[model samples]
Target chain A: MLHHTLKISLVAAACGLAFATTANAEEVTTERHQAEITTVAEGLNFPWGLAFLPNGDALITEKSGTLRRVGTDGVISTPISGVPEVVYKSQGGLLDVALDPNFAENEYVYLSYSEADPAGGPGNSTAVARGKLVGNNLQEVEVIFRGAPKYESGAHFGSRLVFSPEGYLFVTLGDRYSAMDDAQTLDNHHGKVVRIWPDGSVPEDNPFVGQDDALPEIWSYGHRNVQGAAIHPDTGKLWTVEHGPKGGDEINIPEAGANYGWPVATYGVDYDGSIISDKTHVEGTVQPHYYWVPSIATSNMIFYTGSEFPAWQGDLLVGALKGSQVARLDLEGDRVMHEETLFAEAISGRIRDIEQGPDGAIYVITDDRNGQFIRISNADD
Target chain B: MLHHTLKISLVAAACGLAFATTANAEEVTTERHQAEITTVAEGLNFPWGLAFLPNGDALITEKSGTLRRVGTDGVISTPISGVPEVVYKSQGGLLDVALDPNFAENEYVYLSYSEADPAGGPGNSTAVARGKLVGNNLQEVEVIFRGAPKYESGAHFGSRLVFSPEGYLFVTLGDRYSAMDDAQTLDNHHGKVVRIWPDGSVPEDNPFVGQDDALPEIWSYGHRNVQGAAIHPDTGKLWTVEHGPKGGDEINIPEAGANYGWPVATYGVDYDGSIISDKTHVEGTVQPHYYWVPSIATSNMIFYTGSEFPAWQGDLLVGALKGSQVARLDLEGDRVMHEETLFAEAISGRIRDIEQGPDGAIYVITDDRNGQFIRISNADD
Candidate 1:
């Protein structure tokens, strides 16, 4: 691994001639490190989420409500039309659409959206519905998971949907801005990523399985919005990312039933430009593993274990909305050695989804009306 | 002044959306504050220096030795010829170009460049020369000041030319990557902005006017390619910006005979990514008024005293290169309270110059081959 990393870094160094002088023999300051950028692909619209099919083809969801297939060849197929109606407001619309781990056999695709219900909008819940892709059309769409006791507001929907390798699905839902009390309640599913079996049955090993006051499916709580999720390549642990209002955008490895802090301890501030709560750590809520000082408006995360960029293996890949780039985090064991910008200025598009392909290459999709599905690889040249 | 400022802030508050229930209510953190960009102009090549002509028109210089004029009406005229030939390569070429403060009456324009001698490229040097514009052509070009011994390196030409309100022309020179010693030598003019009279004669009031070890025209020493220069509107201070190799892009309010720390105590490192030294406070070299941590590759600067944005009056406007925007710093007296991104992603160009026109409107010129000149006014809904 060391030799492969050095080889790839040498190749990268050759192209980054501008940085030859930047690799000082002395200690590197925050500004002195050099990172290289190469164009991967172009043309994507507010692509909000992605899921890898077993065959390596990826499904991408546009916030404007279109499910498209990004084949391994990097071509964007026509929209597959089983997506539900999305409000698509300030922070609403169709969000976090993922594919089942057994997509090749089961063909079940999962999606989360702000469900428009009669009761205000916690009526706006992170609805996890599954369907089969029947030749560019969804066949037999079923609402697999839904949060209870709707409230108002479409502001934040922690709609990222992911399935653990153990065959259980996790659905992240936001506080819906109606109340923070719902986060502590077990009967309600707000502000948590509820863990359940494929048939929407509560997991027997859930944190609060027999607790009468708590919802049996609640895996974690007090999440602002979980936009990015991926399994750790080596550890197989579930990692997630949440957006803090003004400053915090946290990356966490959550323990089951742990309460992640929101509306309380956050690096972010209120939109009125005031301190959110003068704290970023509450005793009961689990802390994030790592956080960004200035929010990158995070979404879509994956850990690199592909063979294409051997140096990048085991690193984390995160999509940033405000950063308008893909962040490649280099880790030396557990400590973050340094962070590099991978598809930053080169892509010039919001990367909403990233998935390692079966062929050891990587695919990314853009989010927005004029987005595209792009593939990233080593330059053939 | 406090009451007036409060009044304007109150008005701004009226238009600003209040903090939602979740807003932190404290001022936004410095990192999360983003600048709003307004494209004042576009279409030009490496537009480096800007001088608001007496009639409110702007004289913008392209690094290709073209002196283009941006009229008050927002029209870009054909090249105002008669600029001297420059060795246009990595860091040389038609560098800092500015006009006399009395340009309306004198028709005199000043230009600086690293011209190629017969031996090789005379390293970056400030050769203050004047040219008179007669219709489409410049007539009777004369050399005002020239470096004694030419350098052959094609870099570090601090060419910004600005005259104080009292008519002392301040010229910035660069230390062609050799070190601070070159700038310290009396015979060499590599890293000094020589201050002189209109006729290029040494001013008796200069700090080293009669010193045997000092150059008569030396105003300040040890600047590393000062790129931006603007006289403080109220204080009449000569402020300069010099590019630091890797990190230190300094904003210096220069004083006579001061050593402004180059090769010593730099906020930046060598271009090759090596740490040069780690000292920010040296006894002799003056400190930067302000410095950028993660450099934006800064360019020209200005102070806004316009009527349209009364609250923004007397604020410093620094052009950001790598950030591709302009920053407006809010000041509490001389202290920077906070900064607002005045021109961010909106003006899709590198800001080369910023000048407050005679009409009290602000104007900017973009850099690069296809740069444009833009005029800024109150945004009309």
Candidate 2:
């Protein structure tokens, strides 16, 4: 359990450089305290996902379908072997990485990515796979989940994954651009969140388990393109950030079986400045807990529970791929109270993923041909 | 002069019907009062703008380049002759209407619409024209203001017009979709709010009157598509609502010589889920007073000053075309304290404009092939 004052740190100014040369402390004055952005590792290609191991080592996933490890001493490893083949197309490829809660004993790691249909379908969809981590390679890999009704459009393949406190795996899915209207239906996996057991089996208590017309693994429905997700430490509920067309990006705490109106009720218009719908609120559809007008193009999010920044405990930190910044959101209970952008344009490139390392420092990876992994910490430390 | 309380009205359900058939008081429960939606007139073609005359009759602009006058008895006259020829296209055509501050003495009515370039250019732009209302004809009509550098695209032709307390005329402009980048530049009127005298002469104190290379009429710059605007009774400042791509619809208080970040500092992304700008906040740029995520597709707005809704005295009433409703925003000084959606799907089409009549009732015009003129008042009245 983490207990600390929520001192907000806003904005950063970090120039891309090698870890050894940048360790001298490049400080940025934020609202509350002075923070430092130090390069952890660089020279990676389109790093998309990151996770920390018990031994303080970090595993990173590149969008081009490669997994690599970085040692605590900042030594970068070659691509790990036996990773699943991913469809590395627009807004797809290797997406999120997560470790089983019992990873210390099981050594299990999970990866989410865009998977081409095995049955020779026209398009690809998001898939989740897990394997045991053994000496630089993932072995016994098995596909755990696959989003349904693939389309040819290369957009909106939401692939973020998180583990609920109840030990169930939750996978976020997108409404493939060509199939956005179907997001409202229950039979398909488009624009949905699913809960399953560790071995790829549907959880018996899943929201749609007993329903005939609905997919058995569905936990919630009616999402646009959810790329960021996390569990609230205090409430033990899953919170997600999704992209809305044109302007309505939203943060939602999805409840079981709830419908989050996508095309039917949205705050954004169509890209061509035409109205998609005339309702931002519908009776049965869940309203976003918080939403961004002129979306930030949110990619990933986390509720700060690490001890590194005592003031950030319980605050929500979100990564923005468009603005290349991190949004630090202060919350009072379920309501978002305030937001401060950390590292706004301080780093050049799209922010792909963010994680709090075991050392308590925040780690973020930039998505680019030559990507860099960086860590944020209190300058005083 | 209007002096009154702001009784906030939220949500409605008035079915489309003839004026007499819908006049029996169809009541809807709002947050502050039981409001009634009465059809004042129906069967107008895409009514876009509405203004009340001293005789209690209303002047309305139909998008198809027609101006009609509706009497106090709900009798709509034939299209007013001598109106400006307009380019009736997507998000264009006849837009806003306002009366001169001294309409009793001058009978000067102002109309803003999409004007085709006289030079036979490829596209059209927003233009404001003024004329005297004599019976059913607009006598001695003259074009007062025209947005510069037209594009071929038929999107984002903002044409909202309002009169200032000091009798200066203000016209809101758009960033014409193809020319969005020019919004951050000065030399053009794209994405700008301009101030001029009633005779179309530039005000000497106008923000950019003498600024080299900048448009002389530009009072403020850096906007997307401004569709809604009103003057705060207490502060006497002009507040505007502009459509943002995707999600970033904003309400801004335009100040002279100020820059409101459009393409540079927006909260939204491009329609293709790409990053527009990662920075929502930038130095030297004005932030919006309020913004909507997954925008409500705001079309027009007015600061409520009618005696009919006492509880809504200072609230801002905004019309939404995408949501087909009015947003009642409660304000405490400059900040938006709360918001309530009025007439969510209660009406059949897009709400293009809203006004406060001399009788202290709220009036709104719907935009559709078969449009309507409606009044909202306390059911007890």
Candidate 3:
């Protein structure tokens, strides 16, 4: 068990050291802020994910489990048909949507969701299925990955999907609100982030491949519900966002076989305000690079590296659900020089998802009926 | 109640409007399809709110109710010493944080949370307060606003804070759980977004200010738990995000006395998979500009107008908690042109808050003990 305290001063100094770099307090930034808000698409029913097609259009997903073809006119084509029925529920439904890393030729699309199980088992688990674009509907739909130890709750089925440049598929799983301790276990898929091949087979060279002591699909463990994962644009390092119970949401640079210490070290308390764990910090349990205390109820994140906003060509953009806003970070070296809140009063809804489109535009989906397919561009700013 | 099915096709039409303005479609971008992940600060318990000092440092808030001043070195100062104890419970704690528009003139910071009843009343309704920053400790702390008809549940205390450029402070309120019927009532503060003066007084020009039919603090009524609100940088329009049970999370632009359906007109079912109200749309209830069929557990949102990232200069960044990621939105007008997912795999946590820093950077607060204080900058993405 890790010892946890609401220490203010002690952790302050160590936090600066963890990042290995510091911001120059004396330095001045003359750059200005100029964010424009324009409507890229009007009506979208819980557009969950975005994939920028090479043709300059985009493919989007709806939580009710529909694949949409959005063209330059913002005209959404017919539901493009051919999607499996998702057991849509609280925090469950057609979730994150992704495109093949090499979509120019194959037109393959990867979708992540809580698939309906006809197997007379638990209701749903994190599932990743692959298919190619045949006309409008998805063709050759095949299950590529499945989360294990499925259970009854819809509270924590993390079904975000991503792909490595190396072509491995990374999928996230929630602990199904049952096994808080199982997040630290290796045998079950609950509360784990897994990596698999495109064909739903475990990669032989994965972090714990062929290891008796570890789960074969695990790239990382000890996560409650991981929603966001992206490969670093510069270093290609993988990073993830994990949810905490009452607080303790985390952004981690997950290493293979590392224990994240769920039901253990936590800055947050339980839902009923119970003690989060016996301790807050434990040796051998990986510490998060950063954490939120009051809990923003975070959703999606992206690194902006486009020409539309030249000065901001290399920055980070993250969406917050509870706080109902977006945060932009200013980094100098490895240290954050400053941080600010933008649009806290503008887009009033939980920002469900964010993506960078092929045309270099940034796209976001609001998880509301007024589930707007809002777009951001230089012109609007 | 609002029927979303009729709007589903309208949603399709909105997508068409979004496609016409592709912000980055013509640009030859430098960065490929990857995002950068960097942790700017650690040791923040629940860095609920992030704001920049004029000199470019940051002030962070923890859910335990302590405010920490974060330096560029990532070092956190001990608690600022002057915050009032919060009614920290299931969903009640030191909640949203914001800066006074005149922070440069008078280091005033505003906070909103469910405060324990010093007078020995129920601790459910939220309150807003302001204090001056003198060194690390807050001075002149004053209760600027208070909620009415205090209930008992810790849930639905939409306590996020925001300040309009017009000098009015906006406070989001929750239905405090199934107080769905409470949203339609004016005597209670259950489900409504309010506009208030800085001194804890009701604004005279408020939409429902003089009317005996509604609470004086009410800016708009008929809302569920409105967790997100923002002021549009261009139009200065107030946008809001509200959560519906099972599915219908919503975004609304407020009109005086407008009704946003809670128990009615949602795409979502109940937690037990039951119908909320037989209707998905109503004649008088306001409709969401966008919605998620499957809820994303919406939180805060931000619109970017920073020069640091030219590509995303004018975009919206939204955070999803249950969906566990940040979303970037490219806008053409009011519609979403594209929807993209960022940090879907990096942080396995729910996003609680998002902010843009003074140095044209992005700051994010995740809600977990491992909750994170992340900064995004030009070099990182």
Residue A120 displacement in candidate 2 (angstroms):
2.7
In angstroms and one decimal each, the interface RMSD of every candidate reads 11.7, 9.5, 16.0
Model 2, range B202-253, lDDT digits (tens) per residue? 9888877777999899998899999888999998999999887777788889
Q: Give the TM-score of candidate 3.
A: 0.47
lDDT of 2: 0.82
Candidate 1, lDDT over the whole model: 0.68
Q: Which stretches of candidate 3 lie over 4 Å from their true place?
A: A1-381, B1-34, B379-381
* Cα displacement (Å) at residue B139, model 3: 1.1
Task: Kindly list the per-residue Cα lDDT of model 3 for residues B88-176, writing each as its tens digit.
Answer: 78778888878888887988988888876667976556888889988987899998877877777878889677777778888989988
Give RMSD (Å) of candidate 3 vs. truth: 26.5
lDDT of 1 at B98: 72
Task: Provide TM-scores for the models.
Answer: 0.48, 0.52, 0.47
Ranking by TM-score: 2, 1, 3
Report the C-alpha lDDT of model 1 over B1-381, residue by residue, as the tens digit: 001111111111211322111111111112423212233344567877777766666777778777766654445667777778777777777766677788778888888776766356534455777888776577788878876567667667777788899999988888877644586566677778789887788888898888886778888887777878888877888988878778778777788888887767677777786877766657877767667655677777777887864556777888877766777764434444334565464456777777776766666777767776655555311
Ranking by DockQ: 1, 2, 3
User: Candidate 3 lDDT, tens digit per residue, A93-195?
Assistant: 7888788877777878888888766597766777888888877878888887767766677778886777877888888778777677888878888888888
TM-score, second chain, candidate 3? 0.88
